[model samples]
Target: MSYFFQIVVSGMVVGSIYALAALGLVLVYKSSRVANFAHGQIIAAGAFITFYLTTTVGIPIFFSFLASMVITFFLAMSVERIFLRRLIGEPIISVIMVTIGLASIIDGLIYLTPFGTENFSFPPFLPQDPLSLGGVSISWTQLVGMIITFIMIGGFSWFFKKSTVGISMRAVSDDQFGSMSVGISVPRVFGLAWATAGLSAAAAGCIIGNITGLNFDTLHAFGIVVFPVVILGGLDSILGAVVAGIIMGLIQQFASGYLDGNWGLNGTGDVMPYVILLIILLFKPHGLFGIHEIERV
Candidate 1:
């Protein structure tokens, strides 16, 4: 039972990270309907930037974190402005291809840096102690990361529900044409959406980097893993993203804890989310919170 509880605790931590990572993807999709393939690259960039500032420039961790967010925020906006802006009305395929290309470009740029080949961890800021209860233990880093994740999530929820800019963004998501009719700048909203997503991505990256250390490959993999999370949650639902991310996290942790060594199952945790993704697509195609659209001729 203690072991089970321990797994639960660990699952929650991982799930929180997934939720934060997936939030950005959902934000981009919700507003602009753009599936950002370069998201993982952005995450890597944020992590690397934070690392550089903290280690090279000797900035404090907290301030470096903020700087990284600001940097990525503008970087994402520039990507949208320079590359995606002109392709706005183009086919979805065109937009997707552009994102893929952007990812490759970012990858190339990172490869030119030491981060692409070397592994690095954040300078320790949290106490090097583990909090334990009833045989379940969590490191300070994980606990702090979870707290930050919840705060960011709450902040985003409040922005969406209460703030004018957030309301405008949501309005754009609901109906771009309608928003334009109401005097909203649809393009500006799109830029803001990307900017916000970038900001969230930076936060997620910093958390992950602190928890797992910095590795370009591992950091960027969050981008691919997030797809299952958002899909399970609902492509355009923020609340759905949170719920699904935690669910997937639990599923992964439990699979690793119970199924990995039993029988021939190995690496089940890594594969389970995609398995569930397939099941969801086959049965609940609209996802848990996704609205089913009916187009009538």
Candidate 2:
């Protein structure tokens, strides 16, 4: 029973991070209707930047974390402005290909840096002890990371629902032409969406780096992993992302705990998400929270 609860705790921690990371994909799709293949690179870059700032620049981890998010925010905006901006009116497939190309370009660029192949871990600032509750133990790093993740989630939820810029973003997402008619800059909203996604990606990166030592490949894989999460949660629904993230996390954790231990199922945790994704695609193609558009042809 204790072990079960422990797995639940672990699942929630991982799920919260997934929710935050998935938000990046959601935001980009909501605004520009383009998927960001370069998102993983951005996540890795943010972790590396934070690591560099903390270890080399002698800044505190907390401050470095903020600095990385801010830096990535503008960097993402610049990417949108310089590359994606030109391809705005292009076909969706073309834009997606550009993103894949951008991902490769960023991959090559990161390979040039020391962080590309090397592994790094953030310096420990939190206490070494784990918090134990009813025989379930969670480390300080995990707890703090989980708290930070939820706080950002809550803040973004508020921003998305109540803020003027957020409202404008939603308006643009729904109808770019209609938003333009009302004085909203569609391009600008697209830039803002990317920037905000970058911000969340950075935060996710820092938390992940703190919890799991940073390796370029391991960190970047998060981009691929969150795809199932966002897909399961409906690409356009923020609430769906959160709920789906938690669900996926729990499923993975439970599979690892029960299936692997009892049935000799190996790698079930990693594979379960894709299985669920296939199921969702077959049965709930729009995802649990995705809006179904009925076109009148």
Candidate 3:
């Protein structure tokens, strides 16, 4: 029972990170309808920047985290301007392929940096001691990560619900032509969406780095995994993203905790989500929270 509780605690920690990561993907998809394959690279860049600032440049970790968020904001915006802006109104397949290409390009660029290959940890600022409750232990790093994630998620929820810019984004998502007729600059909204997504990606990266240590490979892989999260939650719903992310995280933890080494399953955690995703796609194509459009057959 204690062991089961331990897995649940860890699952929440990991699920929170997934929720943060999926938030960015949902932000971009909500406004632009563009699935960003380059998201992982942006995440990797954010993690590396934080690592560089804290370790090499001698800045504090907190400041480095904010700086990385700012940097990726512009980095993602410029990427939008250069690569995606021209491809506006292009076929969806073309746009997706372009983002995939951009992801590859960023991966190649990161590979040139020493940080890409090396493993680095944040400076020891948190207590090494673990907090315990009835035989379940949680570390400070994970606790902090979860706190930051919830704060950010709450902030984003408020943004989408109350902010002017966020409402404008929702308008565009609902009907681009209708929004444009009302004088909303659709392109600008798209850019802003990408920018916000980038910012969230950076925050997620920093938190993950602090908890798991800085590793380019590990940080970027979240990009791919976020697809299942977004799909399960409904691609355009922020609430869906959060709920789905937690669900996926818990599912992953439970699988790895109980299913591994039973009947020769090596890595159930890594593969099960994708399998579930495919099953979801086949049946619940609109996802749990996705808006349903009825087409008369």
Candidate 4:
């Protein structure tokens, strides 16, 4: 019983991270209708920057985290301004290929640094004790990471609902021509959307770094996992992303705990989520929360 609850708790933690990761994809897709293949590299970049700032630059961990977010915020925006800005209104496949190119370029650049070949973990700043509740335990790093992720999620939710720039983004997403007729700069909105997604990616990177240690390969693979999250949650729905993230997280954790050891299954945890994704998608092609966009003949 305790073991079951413990798995549940672990799933929530992972789910929240997945939710955070999916935000980047959702934001980018909402504006440009292009998927970013380079997002995992951005995540890795932010984590390495945080680690560098904390260890070598002598900044506090919290401050380092903020600094990394701001830095990546600009880094991502530059990628858009320099490489992608001109590609606006081009074929969707062209834009997607550009993102893949950016991913490979970033991969090459990171390889030149120590973070590319070496594995590093953040120096522990929190107390090294796991908080136990009813025979279930969670560490301080996990608790803090979860709190930060939730706070960011709430902040983004509020931004989309209330802020002016956020509203502009929403308008552009709905209809770029309509937004432009109303004097909104569609290009600027697109740039801001990418920047905002970058911010979210940085935050997710820092959280994962704190929880799992900074491994280039591990952080790099996270982008691939986010596709299912976006698909499960509906690419255009923020609320759906949040719910889907938690669902997938819980599913993976529960499968790992319950089905791994007793049966002949060895990697059920890794395989089940995709299986479920295929099954659910067969039923709801637009995803659990995706809008049913209709085209009139």
Candidate 5:
């Protein structure tokens, strides 16, 4: 029972990270309907930038974290402006391919840096001991990361529900033509969507880097992992993203804890999400919160 509870605690921590990372992907898809293949690259860039600022430039970690978010916010906006802006109104395939190309370009650029080949961990500012309760223990880093992740999630929820810019973005998502008729700049909204996604991605990357250390491959893999999360949550639903992320996290942790060594399975945790993804697609393709759209010719 204690082991089960331990897995639960661990799952919550990991789920929070998944929620944070998947939030950005959902944001992009919700507003612009663009599946950002370069999102993981952006996440990696944010993590690497934060690391550089903290380690090389000697900035404090918290400050570097904020700095990285701001930088990526603009960086993503520029990406939209320069590369994706002209591709607007083009075929969806063209946009997706462009993002894929952007990912490769970012990968090449990172490979030129030490981060691409080396591993690094954040400087520990928290107490180097795990907090324990009834045989369940969590590290300070994980606890702090969880707290911050929830705060960011709450903030985003409020922004979407209450803020003017957020409302405009949502309006565009609901109906771009109608939003434009009401005087909203659809293209600007698209840019804002990407910018906000980048900001969230930066936050996710920093949290992940702190929790798991810095490895280019590992950090970027969050991009691929996010697909399962968002797909499970619903491609365009923020609430669904949060719920599905936690569900996926719990499933992964429990699989690792109970199923990994029980049979021939060795890495069930790593593979379970995709297995679930396939099952979900075959059955509930619209996902838990996704609205089924009907089109007639």
Candidate 6:
């Protein structure tokens, strides 16, 4: 029972991070209808920037995090303005391919840096000991990461529900033509969505960096994993992303906890999501929270 509770706790921590990461993808998809392949690169770049700020420039970790978020915000906006803006209203396939190309370009750029290949962890700023409840244990980093994830999630939810800009973004997502007719700048909303996505990605990246160390590959992989999260949650639903993220995280934890060692099923957690994603696509293609738009043959 204690072990089960421990897995549940850790799974929630991981799932919240996934939720935050997927939120960025959801934001972009909701407003622009273009899936960003460059998102992983953006996440990796954000983490690398923090590493540079902390280790090379000697700033404190906290300030470096904020600084990285600001930088990525502009970077993502520039990406939209310069690259995606021109391609707007073009074929969706072309837009997705452009993002894929941009991802490759960013990947090449990161390969030039030393941080790309090395392993780095944050300086020990939290307690070394784990907090225990009964037989279950939790670490300070996981606790902090989960709290920040929830706060960010709540803040974004409130922003979407109440703020003027948020309302405008929703309007744009609902119908670009309708939004434009009503005096909303659809393009500007798209830019804002990307900026907010970048902000959230940076936060997710920083938390991941703190918890798992500054590994470029690991942090960037979240971009790929986010697809399943969004698919399960619903492509355009923020609430869906959160719920699906937690579910996926639990599945992963359970698979790793139970399926490993008993059989030759090593690393089942890593591959199971994609398999489940395939199954979901076959039957419930729209996913749980996704707006169903299936056309039957």
lDDT tens readout by residue for model 2, 1-297: 999999999999889888988989899999899989888889998999999999999999889999999999999999999999999889989998998899899899999999999888888899999999989999999999999988998998899999999999999989999999999989999999999999999999998888999999988898889999999999999999999999998999998888886755688999999999999999999999999978998
TM-scores of the candidates in the order shown? 0.98, 0.98, 0.97, 0.97, 0.98, 0.97
lDDT of 1 at 92: 96
Candidate 5 Cα errors over 4 Å, as ranges: none
Which window of ten consecutive residues has the lowest lDDT sum in model 4?
A: 263-272
In model 5, how large is the Cα lDDT of residue 263?
A: 70
The alpha-carbon lDDT assigned to residue 84 of candidate 3 equals 90
lDDT (10s digit) by residue, model 4, range 1-297 = 999899999999999999999999999998878789899999999999999999999899899999999999999989889988899888988998999999999999999999998989999999999999989999999999999999999999999999998899999999999999999999888888889889899999999999999999999888888888889998898999999999999999999988998868777877777888898789997888888889999
Weakest lDDT window of 10 consecutive positions for candidate 3: 115-124
Candidate 3 lDDT tens digits, 49-85? 8888888999988998999999999988888888998
- Candidate 2, residue 29: Cα displacement in angstroms equals 0.8
lDDT of each: 0.94, 0.92, 0.91, 0.91, 0.94, 0.89
Name the 10 consecutive residues with the lowest summed lDDT in model 6: 115-124
> Candidate 5, residue 200: CA error in Å?
0.6
Q: Residue-wise lDDT of candidate 1 within 1-297, one digit each (tens)?
A: 999998999899999999999999999999998999999999999999999999999999999999999999999999999998898779999999999999999999999999999999998998998998878899999999999999999999999999999999999988889999999999998899999999999999999999999999999899999999999998999899999999999999999999998998899999999999999999999899987778999
Off by over 4 Å in 6: 294-297
Error of 2 at 122 (Å): 0.5
lDDT of 3: 0.91
Clashing pairs in 5: none
Off by over 4 Å in 4: none
Q: For model 6, how does the per-residue alpha-carbon lDDT over 123-198 read when each residue is reduced to its tens digit? A: 7778989988899998999999999999999999999999999999999988889999999998899999999999
Give the clashing pairs for model 1. Answer: none
Name the runs in model 2 displaced over 4 angstroms.
none
Model 3 TM: 0.97
Sequence-dependent TM-score of model 1: 0.98
Of models 1 and 2, which has the larger TM-score? 1
- Model 2 TM-score, 2 decimals: 0.98
Please state the error at residue 55 of candidate 5 in Å. 1.0
